[model samples]
Target chain A: MTIRIAAVGDIHLSEHARGTYRAHLDGIDERADVLLVAGDLTRHGTVEEGQVVVDEFRDLGIPVVFVLGNHDYHSDAEQEIAAMLRTAGMYALDDSAEVLLDGRLGVAGGKGFGGGFAGKCASEFGEPETKAFVRHTREIADRWRIALKGLDTDHRIVLSHYSPVKETLAGEPPEIYPFLGSYLLAEAADAAGADLIVHGHAHAGTEKGVTPGGIRVRNVALPVLGRAYAIYCLGGEEL
Target chain B: MDIWDPPHYVAARVQRAIAEDERTNELGIRVDIRGDHLFLQGQVCEEDQRERVAQVAAEAAPGMVVHNEVICVAVGEPGEQEVL
Candidate 1:
């Protein structure tokens, strides 16, 4: 069975974001089996802003799966925003996956992270606040690793908000390299094994790469240099 | 009006000093210029944030110099480039 997933990210909408995606996603049902958002749905982490995105997703006749982006945490009201998105018939995944409506494909997901590359990364046992940041990304990595490991499907796909390898950080300046993608995410994908890994958050970064283990990676940040969405095939189980 | 002076009163005198401190020193970051002079003082996250603050400050003051005192707070540690 073949499945087509419509995906995009970094909508960055606020209460004023109502008109943003509806016009774009109105014909979604005819597009694919599921809609995947790689994160940054709300601009300031406001529930009202998330609600705006949620309201727009109501136009979809298929399942919508997504991971929360850093912008979604700007406000402490993340739970409220998650609740609102859930109420709008979207599945909010963080290192988790669900059997796609077709059942042959399992979509695993996580928000992933940004810590540059392996040479420069934050250790979890640092200052209290610093520790929190490092630990958070580690947690994101570990959870995704586990979630992907747990899935049993004909086709496995991973969705993330942060780029997984340096290969995707092409156009971005070297000074800002670490901010665009994280090696931990690539590490996790390699260990768990996946067919296709989709992500965003590298607005200036390139759009493709591979884990050391050779799993395919795709970056879909809307403002990134190329196409808004990537179309791939799940007809064969390569792994 | 309120005695809550936004730590930027001394911004003009402390750009390098603030930029060297582990918590507030930065290289390519932009600073915001709000609640004060065309030059604003604040702690931003990344160089992008700094650049953004500078852009906003400049637009806010078309002719005046938007003195940038916005220090980039290294979320992790120094000797490092980013904390994101």
Candidate 2:
């Protein structure tokens, strides 16, 4: 049985976006078994924007899971946004995991942070601010790892708002790579061995990559996907 | 009298200007200074954001030439394969 997973990120819906996504996201029930939102669901992370997101997905009769992105924290009301999303029946996974399709598919995610990539990345031994920056990414990645490990489903999928591997950030300016995502998330996913990984936040980035452990990574930012969503069939003979 | 390079001053001012503006702050636009020229680059979700960035840069450094290279692409406008 192939569980179709549809994913996209960086919607950045605002007041102006009211009713914009409905036409684009209608009838997803026939196309996907589940929907995964990778983050930036709001332009400024307002509860009103979150309401718009809820309204967009309320009628899409399928399970929806999401992780918040940096933009979702801009207004510092991410908790309110998360709560609203939850009330609308979407799972907001922050350093958490969920089992779907009768426990056959496990999903885990967090709002991954950035501290550069492997070779040229930030370290915890520098300035206090620098340490805090890198430390946050490390902590999120660790939580993701633990969440993935705790899942006992037949197939595992990792979701994140920030890119894990630099491969997906290829088209973005090289100078901003550190801010785009971190290698720590990739390291955690690779360590846990996921069947697939999805993320957003890199608007100009490519759509595909593979972890060091060969787990497939995809950047599903709405801009990158150029679509309402992309569906991936998981846990079949193909895997 | 403290002497600072004009370009550096312009860059610093532009940086603060962008940071102070809510829309531009969310855009995370980067300001680069080369001599008296200011280059702005980042991904903004709206066309107005691009214009606002240039406006902010201009206001920050009145005499500096502003080169606005920010890309304004609406999110989810491309490759929309919704099964409608």
Candidate 3:
């Protein structure tokens, strides 16, 4: 049986955008079996905005899994927003993993950080500020590695708000590549094994890419997709 | 001589304002300064958000002609499913 996964990111919903987006989700149940929201569900990350996200996503009949983006941390209320999502019966992952589709599929990841790609990436040396920035990405990658290893399923997927490889961020300015994503994320997923990786946060990025390990990567940022969501079928003949 | 703010600096400031301003927390809006005009370009999800982004850009770079060229993103139905 193929698991149809519908994914999107960077919705940036707020009070002003209350029901405008949900209107587009009509008939989503007919399109996919599950929905994966990469991140950036709210414009300001406020609890109020989080409520908007809940109202927009709740009762969709499909399992809705999400992570918090940098925009969702603006008000230092990321935890509160995540709690709200959990209360609404949604899965909010923070460097964790979840088994869905009756344990046939496993998803691991969180809001991946950025430090550029392999050769051009940042190092944990030099000033404390620079080291901290790179270290944060390193830590998140480590947690993902652990999460992926713990999962025992037929297929595995990684969901994040940041890109894992630069291939998906082609249209974005090269100068900002370091801030868009890091290679550490792809490395962890590659080492632990995954069927696919989904991410966002690069509005101008493209939609498809692959990790060095041959895992497929898709950037479902709403702007990049020009649609409400994208559906990817796993456990097919191609896989 | 009134030394005008550097065009790059003006664009950077406006871009930062669009991302950081409470009224408009849009992170991907592109702000560009050419001569005396500042152009704002990006896809917002709502018409009101487009206006709010433009308003923040104009307030960030007063005295410059601000062009609000940002468009609203179309959230159409779910397209074809890619089998992997």
The DockQ of each candidate is: 0.05, 0.24, 0.77
Q: What TM-score goes with each of the models?
A: 0.73, 0.86, 0.97
Model 2 segments more than 4 A misplaced: A237-239, B1-16, B28-42, B63-71, B74-84
Interface RMSD of each: 15.9, 6.5, 1.7
Error of 2 at B60 (Å): 2.8
The runs of at least 3 residues in candidate 3 whose Cα sits more than 4 Å from the true structure, single-residue gaps closed, are A237-239
* Number of clashing residue pairs, candidate 1: 5
Question: What DockQ does candidate 1 score?
Answer: 0.05
For model 3, the local distance difference test gives 0.92
Best by DockQ: 3
- Per-residue alpha-carbon lDDT of model 3 for A151-185, expressed as tens digits? 99988999999999999999998999999999999
User: What is candidate 3's TM-score for chain A?
Assistant: 0.98
Quick one: best TM-score, which candidate? 3
Better of 2 and 3 by lDDT: 3
TM-score of 3: 0.97
Q: Between candidates 1 and 2, which one is better according to DockQ?
A: 2
Across A1-239, the per-residue lDDT of candidate 1 in tens digits comes to 66666667765665654764476665557656677888887767777777787888864788888788877877777778777777877888867788877667788877777766887776777589877766777888888888888888877888888788888767666877666667888888789888878887766567677777898877766655233354455663321
lDDT, residue A225, candidate 3: 93
Query: lDDT by residue for model 2 over A87-168, one digit each (tens)?
Result: 8878999899999989988999979999898898889996899899999999999999999999999899999999889999
Q: How far out, in Å, is residue A222 in model 3?
A: 0.3
Error of 2 at A156 (Å): 0.9
